[model samples]
Target: MVANGHHWDPKYPEYEGKFTGKFLHSHDFKGVTNEWKGKDILVIGAGNSACDVAVESARVANSVKLSMRSPQWFFPKFLFGMPSDVFAAKTPNWIPSIIKQFALS
Candidate 1:
């Protein structure tokens, strides 16, 4: 079966033969924390899904290893009564960060 992300990381192939633990998709995690829930999890990737999974998993898991090829950012799902994903992008760039940050606080 095809993987979740659009592009498969080539290095991940090595983990198929190396990693000896459960491999789960964040999309399927419906709050059913698994047996490995209490242990540290190495979440591979920095995309939205990876970040989301890491945050959720961190609640139950001791720690999370957010492996990222490069940096990533995630605005909140809601801000000012709108989805931050769209709002952050639409907000005028001229607005100072402190003002927005204060409003959010």
Candidate 2:
């Protein structure tokens, strides 16, 4: 990630019209203009990415609104039915790195 001139724009371009991972579902209008700092922010998506942006933007913005065009297939972020961040936190640090290497291999 490259944060140049107040924007953290990725230096890389998309690969063959595909994205490799989850990301914040947001608009560039607010980020480039800084008009979204204190206004009611509305995100128009329902994937996990959208969920993350909604949560993060609410922290700095006055309010948030999520506008979904269609229903998304939602899965609870969990481990054995409980939210997974807790377990992920407890996960051995080497495990994720190893898993990532294996996936790329």
Candidate 3:
């Protein structure tokens, strides 16, 4: 069976009701536009989408802020010489699990 895990509904913060400024969901974000220029932006969450939004917003927005409930460790796109995901994909399955763990560490 195939399963699609995407969530359609956005989980907004409790304080969303009290805020009066412009608010948008990541699901609805198209790209940086003229309206976004010089506007202060606040991106919530620490997931891939949130990071992408914050990075893009910083380019055009006057200021960009990221808020996360907990700390998250971020890794560079490249590990050693190649892309981190590519490195993982190229690893031979025959390699011992312990060796793979050590190398990743």
Q: For each candidate, C-alpha RMSD in Å?
A: 5.2, 12.6, 6.4
lDDT of 1 at 91: 77
Candidate 2, residues 30-87, lDDT tens digits: the string is: 3423544676665655655556666767777788777665666554476655566675
Question: What is candidate 3's lDDT per residue for 30-102, written digit by digit as tens?
Answer: 8888898999888877777788888888899999888877898876677779998998899999999899777
Writing each residue's lDDT as its tens digit, candidate 1 over 1-105 gives: 112364433232244356566776654555535665688788777766676777777787877787766776656678878987777788788999998776655
Better of 2 and 3 by lDDT: 3
Error of 1 at 1 (Å): 16
Candidate whose lDDT is highest:
3
Report the error of model 2 at residue 68, Å.
0.8
lDDT (0 to 1) per candidate: 0.65, 0.52, 0.75
Model 1 CA deviation exceeding 4 Å by range: 1-4, 7-12, 26-31, 80-82, 85-98, 101-105
Local error of candidate 2 at residue 26 (angstroms):
3.7
Give the winner by TM-score: 2 or 3. Answer: 3
Candidate 2: regions farther than 4 A off: 1-35, 72-82, 85-105
lDDT of 3: 0.75
Candidate 1 residue pairs that clash: none
Ranked candidates, highest lDDT first: 3, 1, 2
Error of 2 at 32 (Å): 11
